[model samples]
Target: YTLMSFLFKLMEEGYELDLTYVTERIIAVSFPQDCFEETYLRNLRDVTRMLKSKHTDNYLVINLSERKQELTKMNPKTLDTGWPDFHAPPLDKICSICKAIENWLNADPLHVVVIHCRVRRNLKPPSQQHV
Candidate 1:
Protein backbone atom coordinates (compact mmCIF):
# COMPACT_ATOMS: atom_id res chain seq x y z
CA TYR A 1 0.00 0.00 0.00
CA THR A 2 1.04 3.61 -0.44
CA LEU A 3 2.61 5.35 2.55
CA MET A 4 -0.30 7.71 3.04
CA SER A 5 -2.81 4.90 2.83
CA PHE A 6 -0.87 2.91 5.40
CA LEU A 7 -0.77 5.91 7.68
CA PHE A 8 -4.52 6.43 7.36
CA LYS A 9 -5.15 2.80 8.15
CA LEU A 10 -2.96 3.03 11.22
CA MET A 11 -4.88 6.05 12.41
CA GLU A 12 -8.22 4.30 11.96
CA GLU A 13 -7.06 1.36 14.06
CA GLY A 14 -5.11 3.44 16.59
CA TYR A 15 -8.23 5.16 17.93
CA GLU A 16 -9.56 1.80 19.08
CA LEU A 17 -6.46 1.02 21.15
CA ASP A 18 -5.37 2.40 24.48
CA LEU A 19 -3.87 5.86 24.17
CA THR A 20 -1.01 5.17 26.55
CA TYR A 21 1.05 2.33 25.13
CA VAL A 22 0.79 2.12 21.39
CA THR A 23 4.13 1.82 19.63
CA GLU A 24 4.50 3.82 16.41
CA ARG A 25 7.49 2.80 14.36
CA ILE A 26 8.14 4.62 11.09
CA ILE A 27 10.62 3.16 8.68
CA ALA A 28 11.40 5.33 5.68
CA VAL A 29 12.10 2.75 3.01
CA SER A 30 13.47 5.35 0.60
CA PHE A 31 14.90 8.82 0.40
CA PRO A 32 12.66 11.86 0.51
CA GLN A 33 11.69 13.03 -2.95
CA ASP A 34 13.86 15.76 -4.46
CA CYS A 35 10.83 17.98 -4.62
CA PHE A 36 9.88 17.63 -0.98
CA GLU A 37 7.39 20.36 -0.11
CA GLU A 38 5.77 22.00 2.89
CA THR A 39 2.49 20.18 2.47
CA TYR A 40 4.30 16.84 2.64
CA LEU A 41 6.08 17.89 5.81
CA ARG A 42 2.86 19.04 7.38
CA ASN A 43 1.24 15.73 6.64
CA LEU A 44 4.21 13.99 8.23
CA ARG A 45 3.90 16.06 11.39
CA ASP A 46 0.17 15.35 11.61
CA VAL A 47 0.78 11.64 11.25
CA THR A 48 3.45 11.69 13.91
CA ARG A 49 1.17 13.44 16.33
CA MET A 50 -1.68 11.10 15.56
CA LEU A 51 0.52 8.11 16.25
CA LYS A 52 1.93 9.60 19.42
CA SER A 53 -1.55 10.43 20.69
CA LYS A 54 -2.52 6.82 20.31
CA HIS A 55 0.26 5.86 22.74
CA THR A 56 2.42 4.52 19.94
CA ASP A 57 6.17 4.97 19.86
CA ASN A 58 6.83 7.55 17.13
CA TYR A 59 9.98 6.95 15.17
CA LEU A 60 11.05 8.02 11.64
CA VAL A 61 14.09 6.39 10.20
CA ILE A 62 15.07 7.37 6.66
CA ASN A 63 17.19 5.07 4.55
CA LEU A 64 18.90 7.14 1.88
CA SER A 65 22.25 5.42 1.50
CA GLU A 66 21.32 3.22 -1.42
CA ARG A 67 19.32 5.94 -3.11
CA LYS A 68 22.24 8.35 -2.95
CA GLN A 69 24.45 5.83 -4.67
CA GLU A 70 21.90 5.24 -7.37
CA LEU A 71 21.47 8.97 -7.90
CA THR A 72 25.20 9.53 -8.07
CA LYS A 73 25.44 6.93 -10.80
CA MET A 74 22.76 8.72 -12.76
CA ASN A 75 24.10 12.23 -12.31
CA PRO A 76 27.00 13.07 -10.07
CA LYS A 77 26.29 16.79 -10.06
CA THR A 78 22.70 16.45 -8.92
CA LEU A 79 23.46 14.61 -5.70
CA ASP A 80 25.01 16.71 -2.98
CA THR A 81 26.16 15.53 0.43
CA GLY A 82 25.54 18.73 2.38
CA TRP A 83 23.88 22.09 2.19
CA PRO A 84 24.51 24.02 -0.96
CA ASP A 85 26.88 26.96 -0.70
CA PHE A 86 24.86 29.13 -3.06
CA HIS A 87 21.83 30.95 -1.68
CA ALA A 88 18.67 30.22 -3.60
CA PRO A 89 15.06 30.79 -2.59
CA PRO A 90 14.14 27.27 -3.62
CA LEU A 91 16.70 25.89 -1.22
CA ASP A 92 14.96 27.56 1.69
CA LYS A 93 11.95 25.34 1.24
CA ILE A 94 14.10 22.23 1.26
CA CYS A 95 15.95 23.42 4.30
CA SER A 96 12.72 24.06 6.14
CA ILE A 97 11.56 20.53 5.60
CA CYS A 98 14.91 19.19 6.77
CA LYS A 99 14.85 21.37 9.87
CA ALA A 100 11.31 20.29 10.69
CA ILE A 101 12.39 16.68 10.66
CA GLU A 102 15.40 17.53 12.77
CA ASN A 103 13.30 19.42 15.28
CA TRP A 104 10.83 16.58 15.57
CA LEU A 105 13.66 14.13 16.17
CA ASN A 106 15.16 16.34 18.84
CA ALA A 107 11.93 17.15 20.68
CA ASP A 108 12.38 14.18 23.01
CA PRO A 109 15.37 12.04 23.79
CA LEU A 110 13.25 8.93 24.05
CA HIS A 111 11.66 9.70 20.71
CA VAL A 112 13.66 7.62 18.26
CA VAL A 113 14.16 9.21 14.84
CA VAL A 114 17.04 8.07 12.72
CA ILE A 115 18.28 9.71 9.53
CA HIS A 116 20.36 7.12 7.77
CA CYS A 117 22.48 8.18 4.80
CA ARG A 118 25.81 6.97 3.57
CA VAL A 119 28.44 9.66 3.23
CA ARG A 120 30.94 7.49 1.38
CA ARG A 121 30.85 4.50 -0.87
CA ASN A 122 32.54 1.28 0.15
CA LEU A 123 35.16 -0.13 -2.22
CA LYS A 124 34.57 -3.71 -3.26
CA PRO A 125 37.39 -6.14 -3.99
CA PRO A 126 38.41 -6.45 -7.64
CA SER A 127 37.24 -10.08 -7.73
CA GLN A 128 33.69 -9.23 -6.67
CA GLN A 129 31.00 -9.90 -9.21
CA HIS A 130 29.44 -6.92 -10.98
CA VAL A 131 25.87 -7.13 -12.10
Candidate 2:
Protein backbone atom coordinates (compact mmCIF):
# COMPACT_ATOMS: atom_id res chain seq x y z
CA TYR A 1 0.00 0.00 0.00
CA THR A 2 1.02 3.63 -0.38
CA LEU A 3 2.28 5.62 2.63
CA MET A 4 -0.89 7.67 3.05
CA SER A 5 -3.06 4.61 2.89
CA PHE A 6 -0.86 2.86 5.44
CA LEU A 7 -1.31 5.73 7.87
CA PHE A 8 -5.08 5.60 7.40
CA LYS A 9 -5.08 1.85 7.98
CA LEU A 10 -2.98 2.37 11.10
CA MET A 11 -5.71 4.56 12.48
CA GLU A 12 -8.32 1.95 11.68
CA GLU A 13 -6.31 -0.75 13.40
CA GLY A 14 -7.14 0.64 16.82
CA TYR A 15 -4.34 0.60 19.41
CA GLU A 16 -2.26 -1.54 17.16
CA LEU A 17 -0.24 0.87 19.09
CA ASP A 18 0.44 -1.25 22.24
CA LEU A 19 1.92 0.34 20.39
CA THR A 20 3.67 3.57 19.51
CA TYR A 21 5.49 2.67 22.71
CA VAL A 22 7.83 0.48 20.73
CA THR A 23 10.52 2.98 21.63
CA GLU A 24 10.93 4.81 24.91
CA ARG A 25 11.61 8.15 23.28
CA ILE A 26 12.02 9.02 19.59
CA ILE A 27 10.89 8.00 16.14
CA ALA A 28 12.22 10.02 13.20
CA VAL A 29 10.61 9.82 9.78
CA SER A 30 10.20 11.59 6.48
CA PHE A 31 7.76 14.35 5.85
CA PRO A 32 4.86 12.97 3.82
CA GLN A 33 3.98 16.00 1.71
CA ASP A 34 2.50 18.80 3.75
CA CYS A 35 2.56 17.23 7.17
CA PHE A 36 2.04 20.66 8.66
CA GLU A 37 -0.30 22.08 6.07
CA GLU A 38 -3.94 22.39 7.08
CA THR A 39 -5.56 20.83 4.02
CA TYR A 40 -3.38 17.72 3.75
CA LEU A 41 -2.68 17.00 7.39
CA ARG A 42 -6.39 17.25 8.13
CA ASN A 43 -6.84 13.98 6.28
CA LEU A 44 -5.06 12.06 9.04
CA ARG A 45 -8.07 11.87 11.35
CA ASP A 46 -6.13 9.26 13.22
CA VAL A 47 -3.70 11.58 14.95
CA THR A 48 -4.85 13.57 17.96
CA ARG A 49 -2.51 16.50 17.45
CA MET A 50 0.42 17.71 15.40
CA LEU A 51 2.95 20.19 16.68
CA LYS A 52 6.06 21.71 15.17
CA SER A 53 9.01 20.74 17.31
CA LYS A 54 11.60 23.23 16.26
CA HIS A 55 12.65 25.60 13.50
CA THR A 56 14.88 22.95 12.02
CA ASP A 57 11.92 20.67 11.26
CA ASN A 58 11.51 22.51 8.01
CA TYR A 59 15.06 21.66 6.96
CA LEU A 60 14.37 18.08 7.97
CA VAL A 61 11.39 18.11 5.66
CA ILE A 62 13.49 19.49 2.85
CA ASN A 63 16.21 16.91 3.37
CA LEU A 64 13.69 14.09 3.31
CA SER A 65 12.32 14.94 -0.08
CA GLU A 66 14.02 16.39 -3.16
CA ARG A 67 17.38 15.79 -1.51
CA LYS A 68 19.06 17.91 -4.13
CA GLN A 69 20.30 20.56 -1.73
CA GLU A 70 21.69 18.08 0.73
CA LEU A 71 23.22 15.97 -2.00
CA THR A 72 24.87 18.99 -3.55
CA LYS A 73 26.89 19.43 -0.38
CA MET A 74 28.26 15.92 -0.44
CA ASN A 75 30.91 14.15 -2.48
CA PRO A 76 29.32 11.20 -4.28
CA LYS A 77 32.41 9.04 -3.85
CA THR A 78 32.21 9.08 -0.04
CA LEU A 79 28.41 9.13 0.28
CA ASP A 80 27.56 5.45 0.52
CA THR A 81 29.48 4.65 3.67
CA GLY A 82 27.22 1.68 4.40
CA TRP A 83 24.27 4.02 4.90
CA PRO A 84 21.96 5.01 2.08
CA ASP A 85 21.91 8.47 0.50
CA PHE A 86 18.95 9.65 2.58
CA HIS A 87 20.74 8.66 5.74
CA ALA A 88 22.74 11.85 5.43
CA PRO A 89 20.67 14.05 7.70
CA PRO A 90 23.07 16.23 9.64
CA LEU A 91 23.54 15.51 13.32
CA ASP A 92 21.94 18.78 14.29
CA LYS A 93 18.86 18.05 12.23
CA ILE A 94 18.60 14.56 13.62
CA CYS A 95 18.82 15.99 17.11
CA SER A 96 15.99 18.37 16.37
CA ILE A 97 13.83 15.58 15.03
CA CYS A 98 14.51 13.59 18.18
CA LYS A 99 13.33 16.54 20.18
CA ALA A 100 10.13 16.65 18.14
CA ILE A 101 9.46 12.99 18.64
CA GLU A 102 10.11 13.32 22.34
CA ASN A 103 7.71 16.20 22.64
CA TRP A 104 4.98 14.27 20.84
CA LEU A 105 5.44 11.27 23.12
CA ASN A 106 4.99 13.44 26.15
CA ALA A 107 1.75 14.89 24.86
CA ASP A 108 -0.56 12.03 25.89
CA PRO A 109 -1.04 8.33 26.37
CA LEU A 110 -2.51 7.87 22.90
CA HIS A 111 -0.16 10.11 21.05
CA VAL A 112 1.62 8.27 18.27
CA VAL A 113 4.73 9.89 16.90
CA VAL A 114 4.26 9.77 13.16
CA ILE A 115 7.54 10.62 11.44
CA HIS A 116 8.26 9.57 7.87
CA CYS A 117 10.03 10.27 4.56
CA ARG A 118 10.01 8.74 1.09
CA VAL A 119 13.14 6.55 1.24
CA ARG A 120 13.27 4.39 -1.84
CA ARG A 121 14.18 5.08 -5.44
CA ASN A 122 12.71 1.87 -6.76
CA LEU A 123 9.81 3.49 -8.54
CA LYS A 124 10.99 6.96 -9.33
CA PRO A 125 11.77 8.23 -12.80
CA PRO A 126 15.48 8.49 -13.69
CA SER A 127 15.35 12.21 -13.00
CA GLN A 128 14.30 11.68 -9.39
CA GLN A 129 16.48 8.69 -8.58
CA HIS A 130 19.30 10.83 -7.21
CA VAL A 131 17.57 14.05 -6.42
Listed per candidate, the RMSD to the true structure in angstroms reads 13.8, 12.2
Best-matching candidate per TM-score: 2
Q: List candidate 2 stretches off by more than 4 Å.
A: 1-63, 66-87, 122-131
Give the range where candidate 2 is weakest over 10 consecutive residues by summed lDDT: 74-83
Point to the candidate with the largest lDDT. 1
TM for every model, in the order presented, reads 0.25, 0.34
114: Cα error in model 1, Å? 7.4
After TM-score superposition, what is the CA distance of residue 64 in candidate 1 from its true location, in Å?
A: 12
lDDT of 1 by residue, 1-131 (tens): 44456566646744221112222322232223432445334434444454345424544443333344443332222223333222233666567657756776578755544343333225443455373
The residue pairs in collision within model 2 are 29-115, 29-116, 30-116, 30-117
Please report how far candidate 2 places residue 119 from its true position, in Å.
Answer: 2.2
Model 2 quality (TM-score)? 0.34
lDDT of 2 by residue, 1-131 (tens): 44355456657753222113234333343323423344223333222222122211222111234433323232121111122444476787667656765665576554544333334433555556797
